[model samples]
Target: MEGTMSESSAPRFRVLMFPWLAHGHISPYLELSKRLSENNFHICFCSTEINLNFIKKSKTFDEISSIELVQLDLPDLPELPPQHHTTRNLPLHLKSTLERAFYMGKANFQNILSTLKPDLLIYDAPQSWISELAALNHIPSVLFIIVAAVNLSFFYHAVNCGIDGTNEAYPFPAIYYRDYETKKMIAMSQESKESLPEDAAFSPKCFELSSFVLVKSWREIEGKYIDHFSFSCGKKVLALNLLNVQDDDTKEEENNSHIMKFLNGKDESSVIYLSFGSEYYLSKEEREEIAHGLELSNANFIWVLRFPVGDSIALEEALPEGFLERVKERGIVVDGWAPQAKILEHPSTGGFLSHCGWGSVTESMYFGVPLLALPMFYDQFLQARLAEDIGVGIEILRGENGQTNREEVAKAIKMVALENEVGELLREKARELSNQMRGGGEGVLHEAIKKLKDLCSKNK
Candidate 1:
């Protein structure tokens, strides 16, 4: 960071940031890069080739003039094609190959670090090995955690607690679901311990090593969790305030897509916006149930439904029979990406049928869109729990075997979107918090930057 006080003669600080190669991680890092660049820091934003291509295509990437895009030349692996550089496009089995390719870039990253000698090195989940490189050269490394603060706090607590796998009452938010049980964590840990590289094993140590922590969430929605995260880590933890969810003037092309046009024609606060995050794809069964639910609710909707990365089947084949024909007048089932921020900000988007990814949750809350959470994987269940606890959304329940039906989904959407009393209450809470969040973000960023600058200057 540059000096706290802006003067023409202030030293230009250089910052290097590398996030995990998933869209969910890269999106926030890019947003942070743009925000930090506003304060006159030059940022080197690093990602693998595939991710860089994706970033290059984003509207925001071109606007970030102060940020230099650095592409990592990952080493080729036996079973992986050149295009399979990121986990997003890779099949489940090739995940290890992806890991191998990631570590192969460490030497190249070392060379870059030596040349840039950045004042601050901020990294996310996958770059844990970079901390030692930064430390050896007297650079201040900060962990820009991209998960919910509650999730971070819980992970830290679980890792340090040294409990047996059978410890059933682990008193964490993640324990809301049976899948997030102690046994599951233990199994996951065992798998990682056996298969993960030594560098990968040290990934969690970034929490212990970094100068401080920066998370994607703010105190407005997760203050207690944030406080616990800081205390648990015994370091400063600051929020970037859901950087991608701001109300600033964005590139019109990004938001003016057909989804927004559809939203434009709907009644105010009447249409439910449905989309899972980019990383996860729903099964055919899941999609049909959701499509049926949307149709049954008689709610106007704009749904961004996607197939698994390279599957090229007709969208109608995956959805319920004649579903599109039945709801075509009132709903538009999008087959690809939608401008999520723009959709949420649209006055017509009343409720979000979400996967409860922290990014999606934050974006919905920031735009005052209540969530109808259908969490499918890690930490999402916890996020859904938080949404319910905050009285901003209702979770769509699942059976003991994690199955959800159309009727249950339909009822949850109606509760969040059309039920007058319940919908109004959630809407009010969401709107109030959204306003408070937008106002609080800049101050938090300013203070965090000031403190980080002081620390970096000392390192210099």
Candidate 2:
């Protein structure tokens, strides 16, 4: 259902949705924008020129006619190369350069808002400077997290520590890092076997400081997460879950199309889906190791290799003798990219060998597919933790030096794809969670839109 303020209410409020360029961030922001538009709020969705180009290519802008798409032209920073469009391709130097650009972008954004005068601004958590910009202009702003509440809680409560303005103030353990058992916790986390609570509640102060702090989770799948947050807020803060739940037939049709093309019937239920997300590119050696492992296992697989192998590192040369010829009929290696969600939802897809990106995990869970998480870095590590904790996945063993070998790779693939007992349990858990997540999403959305309408009415 479309969200709306009361009919009697006049349309006065304008909203600006400024999301980071990644699809993981952009999709959720778009979903929220759609709900806001139904309330008759004037909306402008902003993106950098590069991201806008991507949206154009995907026809995402065309899907939402009511919300105007605005592409911001970034000035030529002397530090950045002109061709650096996709953030995924950039190295650490370019990332630092981009952070500086974002600060400047905030100033440019303020200038644009001077004329447009949006009543509020909503941005991803990384854009903390945007909050300062909004405060300067007397506009209310909120931080929208694309991650689950449990992860956010860990960041705020566990990982971070600060000393007070007075040097005399002692460093007390934060809410997230409670109970003072630090060394043991650290060791356990390293083992990759420990499990934290499946969920966590939002903090009271987080709600008190913001007009709304939007999180991308629903009550059904995360009842404990929701219950913890709800009680802490005392019903004062609004919790919204924006998810586009796909119906059975629609999911099946999309999945089937991808599956048929990829599989072409080499071996039934033998194909594994391998995608490590856009940002995490495997080195040439690692890629070779993976290729060798897949061939050794003799399993049919589709691997999404985003980066091309260097001229000196040809995949064919790297493979074991007669490996390519043997598995040529068994495996399909897709270069650059693939429609991840569609492939994950396919009936022929037995398991996912993923980078453990939250969007990837969510898609896998929604379709009830089991996982073999190969987290390389960043939030992926945390996602791996959640996946294992939730009993929906098993972590692929990376060596002490944070590397994967041919033997480990072969074993992990076999475990998730061929092992009946483990895969069955995982599929069952995933299905249960999937239903809860999609089921609670609607109720949460309805309540959020209502609260938004009420707030809009009060402003009038």
Q: Could you tell me every candidate's TM-score relative to the true structure? A: 0.90, 0.79
| Global Cα lDDT for candidate 2 | 0.63
**Overall lDDT per candidate, in order of appearance:** 0.78, 0.63
**Model 2 residue 414 lDDT score:** 84
Backbone clash total, candidate 2: 1
Q: Which 10-residue window in model 1 sums to the lowest lDDT?
A: 162-171
- Residue-by-residue lDDT tens digits, candidate 1, 222-274: 88888888987898888777556523235644554666678888888888988
Residue 269 Cα positional deviation in candidate 1, in Å, after optimal superposition: 2.3
What local lDDT score does residue 57 receive in model 1, on the 0 to 100 scale? 77
Please, what are the lDDT tens digits per residue for candidate 2 over residues 96-128? 455555555655777766766677777773644
Clashing pairs in 1: none
